[model samples]
Target: MSRGFTLLELLITILVIGALMVWAVPSYSSVSEKIKMERLAKELSGFVLMAKSEAVMRRERLWIHIVMSGATNSSGDWSLELTDRDTQGVGNRLLHLSGKPFDGITLSNTYTSDQISFDETHGRPKSGRISFHPINASTDLLEMRTYHRSAIVRVCSPNSALYLNYERC
Candidate 1:
């Protein structure tokens, strides 16, 4: 016989490769979503920290805004801005951190209150929570039909006493 794989051996090898692909594909997709969620959370945290730092360093009230809007699997839009001196004044666009990583992700604030302001004196936040949901589906317990994805990343600042990484938020 020639020094070549037999038909039976080749078939078995192909079967094995196919089986592995079947198992790997779904896992890869789920893991990708998880990674996206983690990355978005980190970016948001960094943005918050940056605001805190700027406010402290400049020693002036720094008001910032973040806007997130996306309906479905469509990529969402998030832009950061610097508000005029007046607390409720219109914000001038500072930077738009391309939210492509979080395109299909849903970002909603649990508190939905203040426009995130850091005091020049202490660099403290107004105390709130921002929740990231991968899909628009709702969770079982919350039952609000707002959050769908089980994988979530939450940025929480329970009180104004929060001092970035230095203190509990």
Candidate 2:
């Protein structure tokens, strides 16, 4: 009896494995991208909530500055920098958050100003949406929204086809 597989059988197995890999690789890459976006969204939402709470607890306003990078001013890595709105001489940095390198995620927001601020009285922020997605792909968008009357930040997906378990925006 043969101890090992024949040449034909080995070739067939190799072909099948290659086919499966071809089918799975792209899906895996896509899922990974979505996951990255989701993670950033969640983190952003949490930070916004933290800023709101800190604003109320400290009885002071807070500003989250959005900094963008890249040549065209729209594609590359971005970060959130938290600071007190009342500080002078740029010495009151509280928190800073940035994504992992090479993720190629870009940030866009609907804020009327470059910064998102929380009120000291009620911790309510100006209504706006902050979004994170891949550099050139919009299908994997994840958004964090703040309402004018609520301190809670909501994370959701605008594109429902990405198969993320988050609520729809």
Candidate 3:
């Protein structure tokens, strides 16, 4: 016999590899999505905290408008703007961030108003919650809650069972 692999052996190896891939792809995709959601929550929280600090340091009102809208699993755009109203009453944009990272995600907030304002004296917005949910999945939900005195970015699952690296709400 020649020192070469036979057709039968090659076919078996390919089928095993294919089977493994079929089994592993969904798990990998789910994990990837969870990571992305976590990152988004953390980044948003950081931005809000930064705005709060800026308002306190500058002693001026800073308004943060977080807007997200679109059908789930569809291409959509979201934006966050930090503005300050000058003496002339013209709004000055301090920092603006916009992106379409929420391709298959849906976002909702519990705040009464869409605009959150941090006064010069207090570096906090009214207590509320911002939640992120995947369109097709039910388990990887994440939320961030802010308190009266501080802006805390808590990435927790609303589900009863814990998922990924997040704690249960």
Candidate 4:
């Protein structure tokens, strides 16, 4: 005959809710970070592909530049720029992770040159290959750590294939 829960019942409910939140918050954050990383990677890769297509279609050279710099207002956010090799006009661009530096995230060693250029024939750089490695230089993979993010854009020779890897700090 009680319209409201007793004090003990209310306390038990509150404790259960708090425990669930404690267990779920971290997992949710991790998942969200993963999604952001994956999305950034995909977008970067797509831009590379588009650049390749443009080169072949226009019968001219094209280049995509990756700049690892601090976020918009922050001091360590990573960003990228894509330009036409001929006109050098802005084609595609992105600033990583929306300027939100996740805790414990940092970019390790990066092995790419300042710019990646594609020829009119949609071929990879005839001069040499650019490799990105973690700061340790033990691997070609870039490590994204707290307050930082790392990105890797790899284009196959002849520009027939392209791959991108992005990680959140």
| Candidate topping lDDT | 2
Misplaced by over 4 Å in model 2 are 1-16, 70-76, 86-89, 135-137, 159-163
lDDT of each: 0.55, 0.75, 0.71, 0.45
Model 1, residue 32: displacement in angstroms? 2.2
State the weakest 10-residue window (summed lDDT) of model 2: 68-77
Q: Compared with the true structure, what per-residue lDDT tens digits does model 4 show for residues 17-131?
A: 9999999998886666555444434454566556556667777766656455531112335544556642323554422223233222333223245455667764343232322
Largest TM-score belongs to which candidate? 3
What's the TM-score of each model vs. the native? 0.62, 0.76, 0.77, 0.56
Model 3 residue 159 CA deviation (Å) reads 3.0
lDDT of 1: 0.55
Residue-wise lDDT of candidate 2 within 7-119, one digit each (tens)? 99999999999999999998998777767776777688889888888889989888887766532133446667778963322647788877554266767788764578889
Instruction: List the pairs of residues colliding in candidate 1.
Output: 75-103, 137-147, 137-148, 138-147, 138-148
Q: What would you estimate as the lDDT of candidate 4? A: 0.45
**For each candidate, how many residue pairs have backbone atoms clashing (under 3 Å)?**
5, 0, 0, 19
lDDT of 1 by residue, 26-81 (tens): 88876776676667666776776776677778787766565555322335665545
User: Cα RMSDs of all predictions?
Assistant: 8.6, 3.6, 3.7, 9.3
